[model samples]
Target: MWTYQHSDFLVHQIPALENNYIYVVADKHSDNVLVIDPALAELVRDACKQLNITPSHILNTHHHWDHTDGNAQLVAWYGCEVVGNAADTKRIPHISKTIHAGESFDIGSLHIQSLDATGHTIGHIVYVIDDALFCGDTLFGAGCGRLFEGSFAQMWTTLQSLAALDEQTKIYCAHEYTLANLSFANSVDGNNPELQARIIKDTQTRNMKLPTIPSSIGLEKHTNPMLRALDDDFCSAYNPGKTPLEVFTDIRSKRNVW
Candidate 1:
């Protein structure tokens, strides 16, 4: 095994399933890597070999096929343990550890805490390790997950909890929806300069074809309109005469078509 250095967590932005992102987190210090929502099994394997590491764990954030589609293949190739939301047992393949909220585990030196995030799915989880957050489809840079299997209330509360993490936490959301989401944010919050700045930043990143992810929690709090559903000023500007829930529902509906 190769000796490890600093920042063992290797992030590979796999653009697949049409804009979805699947990250391969490897800790070289431990000679182990955890595949978070492996979009493709071969992709995960190649990523590990690229860094001379092996897959020890497969973490699924939700039961979505885009996220867990590589489960069986990864597990078979490396004999990794597949851990996922306790509610996704039957749907997602190879989920060996069905976890719940507050469940904590370790992969070598790093500690992983599972926070149940319900908006995306009943058992959708946000994995917290040190100052990093892997929030699958539940939370994005400028947007959030749809009410596919959960409710607005659940989504709102879950997002609030995630926001409470350290401001410096690197939020690795599982999609490349930032630019599109930021566009919707600007349309909804026309007067927000922070939103404008984000749009410009996103454009530059895309122009360079660079990864526009792993946004800071602090930045998301300032610019993400979806996460500001409770701000009275934001709500009023979003929909002049609508209630908070109405504003949220309206924004969500419009973004659905955007």
Candidate 2:
């Protein structure tokens, strides 16, 4: 067995593409492991070796280069099944299982759930395991992926689904945009004490050369101005008299340029 019945899963954060964070999940009892968004295959492979884990499966959240750049290499190395959104096999190149939203699978003792999130990109997806969510480029700690393939409405709905998860879920988003996103949050909602406090914490993380990731979903709900669309305080600070969606639009725009 790669993992004992009660062993907690392990995750490794691999930095890439200016700020992208790739993840690898593994079972501790045995050598089996699964790679998520293998942006750097060799690094992922080496990391697995150092941890005494062997990659036998891969989950790609999207077809973006930063997410799937190492797919071919990793697949060749592990003979792993490459999983992704069914609608994106043509673009993804190595998708062995074209998974749908809500599909379930097993990785060691963990039962995984796939959530389709089409906002940053049309085929963007987030994978959930236990209390950890591998949200490729959809929901971030304090921001969201750019509207590269879907509408704000789509992203909005997707975020709501993620928020509906258990409050303690550790969100492993795909990038290290916390500092930049927090900067934009402060620019728009400086009066929000929670948001302000989060910015301080994010700064401290960066100052310590630590990744401000694996952020809890509950904290994101309270401090992420982008995620607080319905909050009157957040909306009022950004647009003064704008509708909720308008406020959301403006906040997104500033984030775009941030």
Candidate 3:
């Protein structure tokens, strides 16, 4: 488990199920914590115990099994409110509250805003709490999620929305795919100095068995190939005279096989 602290929230990054990440965000003042994408109940339970905090809510970014597998168990154990995208009520288990894009809520003193991130899944949503973005599989460190139930245009639009956020916002995407994603990013934008530096830095971090997550929007904008689909260089190479959506489609298709 890796821990990161914001001004009023504490985030725990729990590694689970191969490369998946389950985040536990707690309010510093109230100790009210919300579990994000709890794939493994035991890991979440153990982390809560160690942190001396109990979960008060569960936030699901999507309906994927890996993201919501422990939702029922956690809710049963904590009697917590489960929040998920309103459009995915049928899919997310034990969801108590359905939220939509631009909706804001309060957990203790922490303010959270939900953004529709529907490319990874049709009803995918990301949570923005303070400076942290609890983006599930919709976005990754150096890449974005596969278009499982949405279109390339949807994914591209979703990513563009995230890219427009505060550059310093820490992206808490729910996966440990930095190394692999950066490798593919290197292939796509090989000439980017920032990307090259990130490849070396992330390689060392992975070699040392450390987590390379919580990447900033600024860093992603500078190095992430998926976010750079609109760049002139990227468009020249992969899109030619095509639109950003067309370039994004080609990049995503290539990543599917990569």
Candidate 4:
């Protein structure tokens, strides 16, 4: 388990189901607890026990089984209100509140805004809480999710929106794919010194059996090749003559078989 101690909340990242991370956030001011992507009930239950919290809400980023498998059990245990994309209500188990992109909601004193992230799946939405982003399977540390049920354009648009966020924003994505993603990033953007440094740092972190998540948007924008698909200089250097969308498509296609 890894914990990010915030001034207003304590964000607990519980490792489960191989690389999946189940997040339990405890609001310090209002004492409100929330769980994001509770992949397994037992893991979430134990984390909540350690924190002495009964989560009042559950936030689901999408309808994938890995993200929603524990929703029913947690809702039964805590009688929590489950929140997810409005279009995913039918698929997200026990979902009680549906929100659309750009919608803001309050979980006690915590303010959360949803952003459309429909690449991995239709109706996928990521939550923005303060400076922390719980982006489940949409944006990885150095890569983006595969276009399972969305177009390259949709996924590129989503990535562009996230890249435009505050540089200091902390990305609390759901999986531990930093090392692998960095390998792919280096394959395409090998000349980037920042990407080289990230590969080394994340490799060391993994060697220590630590979570290499909660990557800053600044770090990702500088090191993630996928995010650079639209950069004019980047395109001119690596994929000259390709339009922004074409560049994005080429990157995603190459990553599919990487």
The TM-score measured for candidate 2 stands at 0.91
True-structure lDDT of candidate 1: 0.80
Better of 3 and 4 by lDDT: 3
Error of 4 at 125 (Å): 0.3
lDDT of 4 by residue, 220-258 (tens): 888987888757999888877888888888988998999
Go through the candidates in order and give each one's C-alpha lDDT. Answer: 0.80, 0.81, 0.91, 0.89
Error of 3 at 144 (Å): 0.5
lDDT of 2: 0.81
Candidate 3: count the clashes. 0
Candidate 2 lDDT over residue span 54-103, tens digit each: 78888998888888888888888889889888878888868998888778
lDDT of 3 by residue, 94-192 (tens): 999988877999989989999988888899999999899999998899999998899998999999999999999999988899999998988888988
The TM-score that candidate 3 achieves is 0.97
Ranking by lDDT: 3, 4, 2, 1
Q: How does each model score on TM-score?
A: 0.91, 0.91, 0.97, 0.98
At residue 221, what lDDT does model 1 achieve?
A: 81
Question: What lDDT would candidate 3 get against the real structure?
Answer: 0.91
As for model 1, its CA RMSD to the true structure in angstroms is 3.0
Q: Count the backbone clashes (under 3 Å) in each candidate.
A: 0, 1, 0, 0
Cα-based lDDT at residue 135, candidate 3: 94
* lDDT tens digits by residue: candidate 1, 1-258: 112122646565566666767777777467777878888888767666776778888898888888888988888888999998777788879888888787999888778899989987888888997777899998897999988989877877798888889988888888888888888888878688888888888899989887678788888988887766767788776667777667777777788898
Candidate 3 stretches with Cα past 4 Å from truth are: none
* Pairs with backbone N, CA or C atoms under 3 Å apart (clashes), candidate 2: 2-30
- Runs of candidate 4 exceeding 4 Å displacement: none
